[model samples]
Target chain A: MSGLITLVSLMYLVSAACYVIGLHMMRTPKTARNGNRVSAVGMIIAVIMTFLIVINKHEATMTGSIVLAAGLILGLAYGTIRARTVEMTDMPQLVSLFNAVGGGAAAAIGTFDYLSLTAGSHISFAFSFPVALDLVIGGVTFSGSLIATGKLAGNISGKPISFPGAKLLNAIVVIVIVAAVVLTIGFPVNAWWLVLTLVASLIFGILMTIPIGGADMPVVVSLLNAFTGLAVAMAGFVIDNQALIIAGALVGAAGTILTLQMAAAMNRSVMNIIAGGFGTGDSNSAAADDVPVNVKETSPDDVGVQLAYAQNVMIVPGYGLAAAQAQHEVAELAKLLTDHDINVNYAIHPVAGRMPGHMNVLLAEVNVPYDQMKQLEEANSMFENTDVSLVIGANDVTNPAARRKGTAITGMPILDIDKSKSVVVIKRSMSTGYAGIQNELFSDDQTHMLFADAKKGLQDIIASTKEYLDE
Target chain B: MSQELYTNIAIFVLSILVGFEVISKIPSTLHTPMMSGANAIHGVVVVGTILIALEAHSVLFYVIAFIAVFLASINVSGGYVVTDRMLQMFSKPKKTDDQKQDGGDK
Candidate 1:
């Protein structure tokens, strides 16, 4: 039995290697598929090895395998089916849901262990500390992720919901939770403190996420994902498992880095993201209303003719494009432009769409060559030389006002679309974006507006370009 | 036991460094898949769930462990499978287009 356990540990080591290497391989698209597969194989091995070791060691309780297997199979079926059937546009919510499950499972393990430990007389600091930590962090992530999903899915209001003294209420909850945690280690008479901590965590999660608006969901989701990872690691310490420690630490570090990255991309601090809320009601900001912005509208045929004649064209895609399911049409437009000897490129912002790299995944679905997609650094430089910069459903990212002072997006990094010789913006309306500000670029003398849904807008351009080329 | 705790701490700290090193290098284009892969790796906690379920001392603990095992398994299996499907869409992008392969995959 000892030898078998040793073998299982060795398998876990192998699985860890696979996960690390798989993440490394994701540096580019070429090996990314293989990277995903390698990590998956690692996971399968870890799960199977655990099964083997668990069943081999338990004789009298072998019947318990039925419940374990049922849970395993059911979870497998539900997760796999959801992952497979989910819309690509809904990926952020799905990821949040996955994080919820991870956090819930970790919290559950910690709760059970802490309860069992308290039933006995001994209250070891080392064991109970990890248990308390796991329950709190896991509980927070579990409820926080669900709230994030609700905001992203529009099932709940995407606007920040804050009442008078909301912050004070949150602070009071934190103090109580901390006190409960300290009590667990100092006073050993009861396990009720653990329950208090759990309840506080659940409330903290909801309160934390509800105040945050849609603009910050990605950062919140990534942070909660990291929290779940940390909780899992704490659970490992509670149970004394090396594999869990390694894997959990890796995830914790990754999520932390990702949260920081997403925040930096938006020019916000992690602390600021946690404390602040953005995107109030639908009222347009004073900036847009204060000025009589001259609007210029153009037909699809004229826009197509310009695109066909231009020597270079660049497409800037954002959340609106994803919401409209227009990636295929964007790809089709690019293909049509190439036929007319116009060099085409896609400029991808780091924070484009709901998640980082979301636009890249969407464009990849339509078989866009990986080489043609430009990161922000490279795309910014290319826009100056391009003849026409096509903005599809992207508002704030391309706003020239970001370069100037005195706006909500002031000092925020933008796509520098104004540098392009001429610009065309496609949108459903003149409504503001998540920033609740006006886009000064709309009134630019050289910019033209082509108001339409992203997919239909692209199709109209494609058809018009075809007619112009034939004539 | 104190020495053993030190070993776990050492592994935890060093692996964290390794995670940052590896994950920091990935471009924004692959962040979603990388995030999913990170979630899947932590699903190793399912191992703990299996151990607890197999030797559950009481009925309540058994129920708790079963729920945990189920959730962890979902995190592992579902996270990987979905991420794999998303990445596969990029497997054979049109190379015939007049653009040079960046070869950044190294």
Candidate 2:
């Protein structure tokens, strides 16, 4: 048993090392492909080792193996189907659901452990305490994560929805869970109390995360993730499993840090996040009145003409690119430009899309070469010397508003797209961004609004540029 | 040999497979945050370990439990810190002049 445990731990160590390599690779848009491959390898190794651990247990039975096989088959089918067909927009929701499952599984495992210990045997007060606590925390995390998944997927509103004394209500639930846990601990034979605690904890988790605003989803995801980790770690304790303990610890600490970072990014307090009700679907979808903004106008043919003849062209992508499903098309366009002997590069802002390095992942999906995807710092420097800056359906990140004072996003920094010599913006319409502010970039003298969906605009430009090449 | 143990093992295997399936669909954008957050919940290992130690009635058990708690705390704390830092950097602005001179958006 010791030897097998050692082997599994060693595999985990190797897997961790691979994760580090993969993280480094993600730093550059070009090397990101390689990074992903490395990470995949690590995951594969971890999976193999996990299997070995499960199989190597001396007392393994046939029922367990059958169960394992069923899970494996079901998981593979679901993952393959989703990976092949799930839209990029739904990715966050899928992830949240997945996280919930993991937490739920861990919590369920703890419950099973408790049930087994008590069944056909004597139960003591000492045994009941830990088991009760485990059931409570795990159950709470599981349900809470489910709600988070629902919210992210837009099945629920993303706005804060605080009711009168929601906090107090949540507090009372927590107290009930604690009280039940204490009862279970004080009377080990009281198995029913543990079950009751589980129910209460589950309710607490849902109430705790439901009211947070959409703007703070990233933070909510992080917090729930932390709860899941702690649940798993607690399970490790009940089973006296070293590997489980170590893995749980790693997860718990990481989740905490992520939650804190996400909260800080939005300039929000963690306490506020716990209080929930921040993003109760207010006016986020209400369209802003399109006040006429100055945008330099240009045609697809003209833009194509510029791209075909330019020495260098930098593609500045924003949330607009993701929304338009334009990444694949954009890659095709870049390829055409490359054939024309034009220097084509993608300048990606750090926070360009909804999440960190989102643009890189989107571009990578279309098989864009890593070297061509430049980070904001590297791309920002090159933009000044570039001949043309093509602005796709991005707004807030490119909005020069971040640079000026007295603005809502003030203290927030943005890409210096304004400094570009010729800025061509391809947007369906002039719309205000998530911050509910108008962008001055649209009005810049050097900027040209192409006024089209990014994908269609790119297609038109691609065809026009092809003509330019033919001529 | 125990049916309960078999049941537990079955559940564990099923959970992982389901987990992997769900994980694959997540957008790469939320990968760090999601992974880091889930890892935090695993900290419950410490609570479990501590509970076991309280019941130990043996010196070796106490030692093992203490070690588990210490390690779990570090993992939980370290992971959360790193994830938070990454998110913070993401929300900050890019340096200006580097972007200004480029005639076109890169």
Error of 2 at A445 (Å): 2.7
> For residues A80-183, could you state the per-residue lDDT of candidate 2 as single tens digits?
45444546555455545545655665555555555445434555543454467567767877788788778766688765666888869888998898888877
Best by TM-score: 1
* Tens-place lDDT digits, model 1, residues A224-343: 888988999988988888778888988999999999998887877888778756423333445547553697998899898999789999999988998899988998888888867889
In model 2, what lDDT does residue A404 have?
75
Query: Evaluated with DockQ, which candidate comes out highest?
Result: 1
TM-score for candidate 1, please give it. Answer: 0.94
Location of the lowest summed lDDT over 10 successive residues in candidate 1 chain A: A278-287
The TM-score obtained for chain B by all candidates, in the order given, is 0.84, 0.63
Candidate 2 residue-wise lDDT, B1-106, digit = tens: 3554444444444434434433433333445444643443343343333333333333443333344334433333333333333333333223222444463576
- Candidate 1 residue A217 Cα shift, in angstroms, is 2.1
Query: Which runs in model 1 stand beyond 4 Å of their true positions?
Result: A59-63, A279-288, B94-106
